[model samples]
Target: MSSPASPTIPIDGPTMDALMALMRLIAAGVTDDDAINDALGGVLGADSDSPQPAGTSPVSSAALGRSPTGETPSVSPFDAVVPLPADVPDVTDTDDGGSVPTEATNTDGQPMGLSPLEFAVLRQNSHVVTGLLKAGASVDYIGGFSCTALCKCCYSFHKNVDLIRILLAAGANPDATTNNDTHSASCLIISVVKNNVEAVKALLEYGADVSYEWKGSNALAMALDFKKLDIAQLFENFEYRKAQKNRWERYQNQRRRDAEDREAKLDALRSRSAAPTGESPTPQPVDGRSTPTGRDETRSPSHAAGGGTGSPRSVRETAQLTENLGAMDWLVPLSDIEWGQQISAGAHGQVFRVTLKSTGDIVALKRFPCHDARSREGFRREVELLTKFRHENIVMFKGAVIDADVSAMLTELCTESLFDRLERTSAPIPWPVRLRWARDIAKGMTYLHTRTPAVVHRDLKSMNVLLDGSGTVKLCDFGIARLREHTFVMTQHIAGSPSWMAPEVLRGDDFGPASDVYSFGVVLWELLMRQVPWPNKNMAQLVGLVGFAGSTLELPDRAPEGCPPQFIDIIRSCFAKPEDRPSFRSLREQLDSLLVDVD
Candidate 1:
């Protein structure tokens, strides 16, 4: 902690910078003037009358309301601020349920000058927040340090959710954030890190993307670091909204295509008959490629559109991919795809069970938008990696399509994901099949981990593990997977769900094949318990507690109801620290030994 600063410090640098530095020192808990003067030494000149720049506050005055001269204000909190506007009526129960009858004082009762809204928000006075709103104090106004008034509320120790809702409802931007030369934070991030559940709820209700990483701190990272699971559970709402948005956009795109197709077809029929035939010609298969580039021939109805002053679609409906998809030999025509039920959707991608119109082969297709640079790279990686990844336990890459709108990769369809199978099945799984699945997963992981540049399946939850018709485990979802060229790679973003996230990964540290082993342990635990690992749905708390706090997922003290002693040992070993954890090959051999009886 800094020694207490002097009331009058020398103008060591630029006046504003010096003032800012002085104020910062005071804010950081420096209080004794002579000690601060002694600390400053020659820098502490006699001049005490430096003008503070507008929109900046003296040290501790913003919240604690201490005077610039280091003397505590003798007046009450309200005495430091201006009165309400004349046009504004008496404060009523309008903003929240009731008015702030008396403004709540700050931690220390010292007073200083700031607007009513600024004073109330900085001190976390709920009644004052509401009353000021009712008294026409604009929540939209910018305050000290160029921060939005709502941001000040977030900085306070007390999170008054009622006032938060009032501010948001009164048109305060939920996404408004504040940043200085050092730290950056939003209302949601602050609320989450503070473990103020109500404030987080209000922010989320107003459309805050808590998972969104702005600067370095995001609500998800904050939740994990702070151990706030209730806040993390709220992240589900954001994901649901994102999925809904993807579905809605698809619906709109399909509707637009349907309308354009009808118009183009009708125009074509008219043009065909306009050739002055004596009677109506018999219906025939008109060549579909009006504007032909063999691969992009049947792009959309826009290709068939005639040159006219008023064109139906001014621009092309589908955007062409900038990066040509790799491996044209395995290419499938977009026109030949009979899109089936969509199985999953995410921010940048979607998955569907598709049937080939040419070969009538059922395949699982994952779609990525053609636009973003990252998505394009991911599309290319999916092709290059999956084609090389030849293993019975891994999903087989069948073909890919470089559609005008989306880049899609097709893989052999499986019966169902392991997560779904576990949830829907009523009967207890036979030991033979269970052992086989355990062995298959271990084998697949071994194949991935032992490669020249090992592929780390960053997301290794049961949901990404598919069970084929023969009940074989096929590890899937390589969207966030990486090729580990070395022993480990550091990742910038949080990739997998918190339920299976390893401690180092959650802490934003270096990840390796061992990260997958940690997730593998969770799967083994799920298999033994027949329950979802950390299904508590409290990500923030679980991440903080388990990820950084050294809380281990305890293997049952004894063997599970059915099982062998080795099974529990396997799960426990997988959960060990990365360096200490067994390799996938070792794990596979162990699993194979268990499955020897079935074979």
Candidate 2:
């Protein structure tokens, strides 16, 4: 029998030598710019002054068969290429004598079969990935394996989620998949298989296709297979939320279109009616009230007060009237407000019981001090936010006055605050009433938290909770409330009352919905005890004790009598770490269940 032929190596000798030199440089930790340049120059047959080609390896020229001056190869003793598997194809020789792998070259002419983005992700170098992106590397470039940069990062065992995020933010396709003999696997599916929750979340937030499957196994199924209940729940919740958001967007778009069409039709009708006619049409007053014209009528006292047309004696009055009428839709003119006794006064402004002159409606008017920009801004923000609220448990926003000298917000008046109710009555509040109040506050908070972008009532206290005429609780005083965003808002100084503030807020840490929950616990304690929390201590003392001394409220041996043990437990849970606090939704459910038991 004839002897079997020897197996041929894929990589050649000179290429192997250059690769070894590069490896040696990496091992020596010689990352200095001058040192790397000089070392690469020597190995790659390039002088210091030679211009390096873009995306080409340092030693590619020498690996093929050329010198720095374009001379034909005179083999050096140092060129010893390592042998790859026989299945690996030989590097293609180029006109410039650079031997790049033929299989690695894509249709876009990318060498090594991978874009800079792919190489950066494979190396798990976020810095490199950023640099490549800044240099215009395609985020969705397909590599030799037909996998995108995002897909490769997801499939990577290292799980460099930061690199994946960089790729995604650069517009990488989250739903891009890799195909094999078995099935197609998307980035999300790969992440699920790897049990990478964060990576899966990132992909989902980027609108990844959740319904994608690999061999009939979807991401949710894969998560379940791996016993990742949290991941499965996340996937399910994401899908549900996405569908709801889509429906809401469609409904909003339809409403907007309908409103535009109606406006257009009304405009057309007005234009036709305004066209020329034989008789002049009666002029209607801009204010929608009948006005005397054509010099045939006398001016009324109200007209004189508002500066009738021919009067130079009332120019200022006319300007003022025009300003009041042309103000924002939500503005309540000063002329319409009949100020009553002052309800309260603070450093920034005063709250007064005011009646509307036009409708005789009683409301609470909060006036922000003039020349104080920050206070005015806070007042404006409160007005803007409260106008969006329409919940029974939330105080109703009536209107606002935004004059330079008088900036105020008007809201529905409540009979009494919870704090005043607790203080004025010596008798213990009934357990049922306390439970009802707690339920009401939780419902209000749940509504606030469920709103778009959510709302954090940073200042939650018995003083801020009001009782309407029918004893219905309504949350008020949103001066310091924050609209929750993706990132936490940092404060230079602490906000909120010390006794009712969360420990984190007292310590000047970032406050979130959980912080509000903590405050709600303190408020609940107040309701149950019918007394102010730490009434004996001042604000400074309270902050020192609760924030720095690590002291928390303690229930007396016979405290909160007639209340269920679970209610007390819920209060205690709120004082725990923020992460451990029950959400407003959970608290609502718990309170609801307690109410059922009471009934």
Candidate 3:
């Protein structure tokens, strides 16, 4: 057992009475000399001396002249105990007047107690106190006044768990009710108040009462009051821990259930195509090689083998075709069409500035390579989408050319993409011009999303937005654009630009309108900063660093002088979560208001 260090209480007359009272209260049956010496030496800061009483070592003699409890010899008549702070109940009412009593209560009313040193040792000497208890100090003894040692340690000082453990091990009743109705077993309350999970765990393990109502407050209420969520979470059961753990476990299980449902849907989609009735249909090969040959000579029933009404005439004609005829006809198609000057090539298709001879108009012809039938059908669907869409800021598709090996689209020609224009300009686009551009883009995106079929330009990068000579913003490149709820639509090898990809998209989940807002945020960032969004960094690294570390894209230190804060706020708002992001209409309204103010 550790020895108590020393005491700091004054050796004044009133203090001696207080220490004598404290000893009489706590040190019952203290007959052993060493035990007495240890307690006295610790409380009085004793040194060794040779002359001492029986059973008391020479150390007891050294302790004789030292002031008891190391208190000051000088007594002040003015210092007296005032009414306790409103939170701390007044435990002293017996012998003194209604004014709170203390050992050194004086004219001004401030409680006098041990010196600072004594107070500190008393707080930290829990180990020594417990050793004294094993040597036989009454666990029920209330030190000084009515407060027990555990209560004194925790309530007088803050969060003294060392003292709490000693008192508790000495069989301190944590659930003990006081005469004034205040639950005085502060060790249990301290665990809850300080959010000490370990102390709480120990208390529960040792059968501390969880249901004990402590002044309409228990461990759970105290944990909640202190807002110690880690401790509060632990109080779900024995105390509260199990409930918090179960709640989290339930949430995890629900997420798993949702994920399983989504996987089942994806798995079903991967297996076969969705028919008109929402049923998956058996697949038939378009190449017709799965059908048997020699139908005419064998005289086999076509309906029996192929499950179709007698289609032998066409099948027979196909079987008769030789490699020579198939080759001769394939080459004739290449010579008829003229290949034009290539304008641009990106991840999707090669675009050419083509002159249509018959129409006598300049048009852009985008040809997509044919890798599979699914890709061919995707290009066809894109053409269909472009044909139906008509907006001032949208590019018009003239027609599509279906060839044996490749698919192509004819559309209006634009000068260059927005990215190229920005690169050409050295200075930031003028504030007014930037605002107008932002408004135009917002209007276009709004129109696209609000359309009846709801076209989502899955890839909304600066490169996909083209500018005409008149500075009109035309959203082009529908190759990666998706018509809503249409799985047949072409999904690019990668869905979006790296810098502009939303968090959800980067996580390999499908994106919606919110994802578009996220891309808009990057675009706004670019416009404001005049720097490449997600500058010079790989997508994975930036995403990981930003998402995991709560990092963000750096904003420009300075904007053009007189730039409105509202516009800057607009840029920030776009980066907000999907639910918090302002709708395009709201954004337009804000810009309109800002523009009016600027004027």
lDDT scores of the candidates, listed in order: 0.61, 0.64, 0.53
Best by lDDT: 2
Off by over 4 Å in 3: 1-338, 486-492, 546-550, 595-599
What is the per-residue lDDT of model 2 for residues 374-452, given as tens digits with 9 covering 90 to 100?
A: 5555666677788889999999989876543456789899858998888778866777788889999999999999988
lDDT of 3 by residue, 143-169 (tens): 232344444444443345566666677
Best-to-worst ranking by lDDT: 2, 1, 3
lDDT-best of 2 and 3: 2
- Candidate 1, position 158, lDDT: 27
**Which 10-residue span in candidate 2 carries the lowest summed lDDT?**
1-10
How does each model score on TM-score?
Answer: 0.49, 0.46, 0.46
Residue 424 accuracy (lDDT) in model 3: 59
Q: Give the TM-score of candidate 2.
A: 0.46
Q: What is the lDDT of residue 297 in candidate 2?
A: 24
In terms of TM-score, the best-performing candidate is 1
